[model samples]
Target: MWLPLLVKRLNQVDMQKKGLQLTAEEIYDINNASLKDAIVQFGGFCTGEFISKEGLLLTNHHCGYDAIAARSTPQADYLTNGFWAASRDKELSNPGLFVDILVRMEDVTGKVLEGINAQTPEAERAKLVSERMKALAAEAKGPENYVTYVRDFFAGNEFYLFVYERYNDVRLVGTPPNAIGKFGGDTDNWMWPRQTGDFSMFRVYADANNKPAAYSPNNKPYQPKKHLPINIGGVEEGDFSMVFGFPGRTQRFMTSEGLKLAVETSNPARVKLRGKRLEILKADMDKSDAVRLKYASEYASVSNYWKYFQGQNAGVKRMKTVEGKVENEAKYNQWASADANRKAMYGNVLADINKGYADQKEYTLSQVYLGEAALAPAAAKFALNFVPLQKALKENKADDIKKATDAIKEASKEYFEGFNVPTDEKLFAAMYQMYYNDVPKSQHPDIFKTVETKYKGNWNKFAAEAYKKTFLTSPEKLNAFLAKPSLKTLENDLIFKTVNSVYNNYLTNINPKLQAARSSMDKATRLYIAGLREMQSDKVFYPDANSTLRLSYGSVKDYEPRDGVHYSYYTTAQGILEKEDPKDEEFIVPQKLIDLIKAKDFGRYADKNGELPVNFITDNDITGGNSGSPVINGRGELIGLAFDGNWEAMSGDLVYDKDYKRCINVDARYVLFVIDKFAGAGHLVNEMTLVTTPSPNASTASTSAEAAKADVLENVKPAVDSKTKVKIKKEERKAKAKMKK
Candidate 1:
């Protein structure tokens, strides 16, 4: 570990020793939900500089996919190997994707609190608050067109006004083929000592005058004033790194029950769904190169989530961190258990939310699995069915029927085309078997029957036949059979329409029943909350995330995954090489990377640790929105790209694990290697402004011995997972006050 493994505080992270002082302005700006477009977005994520002059923007590889997917055809397989324009003119245009620039921020806490207080009836209160906020946003105007969303927390205790400038000048720049962008596969996700190059490049295109623009071939790359320069000097133990991005989601403010639900119910359900998706996508991808290419991005997108869910599960289990969820729940229970009046108002609410979870618990989980498993194979058939549906709708035969048909028409174009029948069917069977064997037989009788009929009661039989007869083995026939104008889609035409019907039944019929259950549990929760609040009304509390700008800080850290499995804080060039398993398609590392390590060509970014890093750690609070953020040193130099977090901390999505969760990031050194060594784009590397270390001072005998010890103790992790020097329990430092302080 060339970087010092950071230790996270359950409450605070002290950084005074690092000369890490936040200006009063920076501290104020960081805490509020304001006009944060410069480096943060309302959605809780952002993009930042790598090479400021070259206009290079660094973000999560996955974050740019919409723009990437915008230009995708069934023919262009960009998501697999990724998109790279040989020249700027070749860049694909995506009009909708934009970078928001923060123009102004104001404290709207007073107004928001007033709005909340005026509303009664919880749901009505929520709606009223939303209406007032939207009216305010609609009234705003600025350099860029953007929407304003309101965030209310601590029961309307806090509010902040945000004004942003949206930049439509965004365009695809470069990305590694998925081979590099997604190396080390599922097993390595969310764990430390990772070797993925999870970086993607996008350019902000502006008009001749450098303002936002719609699609234009002549649009030039916008120049940014604060693009980060690479400090190739690299990272070492005891170094400081901070990430700036709109981390999309985090649950630093979840109730204990909410946290427990995430750990016990949500995570498992997500994992099951993702697993089903991967099972379907992998089979289809393997059947043909065309299918593989067409669905490459879609598949990769699903895989990212699949890996994430599993990683989150693993992260929690590895560190014995699940205790956080239970403890949090207990705290909530304690607070809510105090009185009668308070409990009556909230009792039903908590009961309702919880019962809602319990009711949909299985069905919601089933939906993700069922979506890909049962329906995707018959997609084209549904498409063909829609032609008749349109004709029927035109005839005005029946509004409800036409509505159903019209619904299928929209779904056919969106969801079905992205699927391959064989892959989907096979995936369905694997999951069906899991269901049949695992879930109680009473819950899903009809789907079980379909499974038995589709495969003749044999999971493999169904999978093999579905592959040979449906999507994978016969794509052309599927297209031909389903696309005929005269075709009337069968009720069994596995498509989004059918899935929608299931959803309607669930939502309209099933979900309501589930809601009723939640309503019941909510009775208990509300009662508890009410009682607790009155008893401790004088006590303070914080609100959960409201999709507003937030900041969480931790230090670079390493933690044990399992009893014997310890992951280091950072990975090195050696770690990447060690994980390369040629036989496994998912784990391949580039030969060029292997050569770079052997050659020791760190170029400008190797830290004093003397090893090129693959990924590093950070303590910045990030969630979904924080994807693709740059982890900068205290000097604001680019050092890493935030990617995944330790799986032990998955529950953090709903419960902040002060000690378990860590932000995983790719070291900037790998970004250079991918560009200079593998991509043969040394020009990009040359454009970067870099920092150099000052010469070391002469050391006396005792000082010399300590320096030597520091060198060895700091830089040990290489291609393999190795022990990296880490900071243990230490003193806390005060957050530096801004100028006013």
Candidate 2:
């Protein structure tokens, strides 16, 4: 199970018993450099780790998909051909990409709850907590570009403060072509027995003092406090494995009613809407490479969760998770009834939670449809960006108008970069029709009335006319309008009016009731958790994930996913060959990689069986944001990158099933093999510290594996001096520039 680094010391005895070689202080220390220093929150959504002192980072290929796709073009299609920087100067800069390293975390529960009591109203309690959190964060702000924020834990029963140093000058180092990196595609995304080499490399650059700074040509590669040593010694069955990173969110405390709503109402609507959007985008993307590059990131983002919701619903039903929660609540109620004080405190917790969910159920599907359908169109969402500029223009405030206009211009760049006019128009028509058919008539936005009256309920005809007239679809048209600045033009714009009407209706009608229900549910959940903790004092309670740093430890082991259907712990190159199908894009293998596998070009990176390991599974508790997390061995060495979870445990975010929840990881050797052999990026490999020795406590080593260890050590090379190579590259670039002059 996952444990917060804040209280890891408290469980040191248990951790050691589970084969953790490192001390608690070695894992996380405020005054000294520890394992935490090497980990970073990649681009605010995923996790990455520093593998070299020169700040070379390693993360999942999908995590870096957007950055790589953003740099791709028709001629230099990095997404298909892959990218490898031959020298430091050749590395491409990603403008908005940043990585945050944890400096420390502090518990401030008492400070945050200083002026709060049980009698305090929910609204007042929230306001007080917000004010105190702001004050605490402001007090912790530093001159060295440190970011501090306080997050509530255990449903607001406790709070913790996190301080981080954010570096903005991250650059792409290397990546395998999608044929290898994304071999299995969506078909095999959350499945096991996989061989996808899902890894990408990047480097973080900082100012001369190694402090955070914006992008600059003169900035040097960051020197981190620590970097993980790479262990080429392959994993064995039952080997101790630990995954450390920032896991996004988990709803382990969700009541039975909440799960019912997600499974029955919210998830289905989202799946249907996204599935339609994906089909349209895919059809267009297949027509041309340029279109594919344009919508690749968008398609990947939508499809990732589209399949996740489907699996979650099925898994929840199969696992009977809702029924399990109901049973637990009954037990809790019985326990509460045994004591007078407990009865007074927790008697109505379950009832309040159930009632709150019931109250919100009527509006739940409406809210889902609104988000999934009404706001799904790109042009409609883009039009909302002009809201500030419209207000400014109405008031005739030049400064506000200028500020808002500049922001819109900046936002338009990214929007139009991935925007496809025909695709968006199709989405507009399909999404609205879905909304009209699904959402209740009384909950329909005012725009539907206009659709019926002006266009006779023909969403396609309405979308066509709207696209034709609105300036939001094209950058040139939007820029032309922005230059003149007409409030009347914006007020009459069809797309703007439609989005505003839908949003305004939501704000006016649906949000208040939802907020009231949420408030009641939150209070009851907090009380229930507090009571449960008190009752089960011996149980070690770990708070649910909230995009905060966490550590989950388990072992490398196989599973019987079903009776008489046992799966192995790891996969190899042979699996990739067996899965390859030239006709199917998902299984297509590059000829170069296929040849290497056929030739058995397995070097020291291979296992004792003379096979190159690809992906492995561990029962490490992880969820969405844990993607790209480092899978470290007991010796605190990098072994693999956690990329996806098994489909059998898709409901793990709500209820973790120890037997079914498996973390799928790309083996570290596979990542290295792709870089050094496949991509010819040996320089990048030369930047990492490679270790061939096995941990002393490793128990499952065979005589053949022990014999192969010596051969592996002989082939392993020491890391080159990255600082010297970088300095040389800089000098060479300057000389070449002078020669050109």
State the C-alpha lDDT per candidate: 0.57, 0.87
In model 2, where do residues sit more than 4 Å from their true spots? 1-4, 695-699, 703-741
Model 2 TM-score (2 dp): 0.94
lDDT, candidate 1, 1-741, per-residue tens: 100111122112354354344432332343442112235341134454435554566776666665566566657867665677777777666654677755555556666546344225666755666677776666655434654555554445445566665567566778886667877666666656677888878777778887767768887777654567676664654566565555455445434455455567656766675666677677767878766755766666667666676666665565454465456445655554555743444434444555555665655444444443444344423434454554564565665455654565455454554565556555555655665664445445454576567656777665555445432224455346434422233343433233444444445644566556555554354344444455566763334545444444445666654443445667677666666777777776667667877888876556555677778776556677667766766555666788877666765555556666688888787887777777877766666676653211212212765565444445432224222212222111111112114
* Model 1: lowest-lDDT 10 consecutive positions: 1-10
Residue 159 in candidate 2 has what lDDT? 90
TM per candidate comes to: 0.75, 0.94
Clashes of 1: 72
Residue-level lDDT for 421 in candidate 2: 89
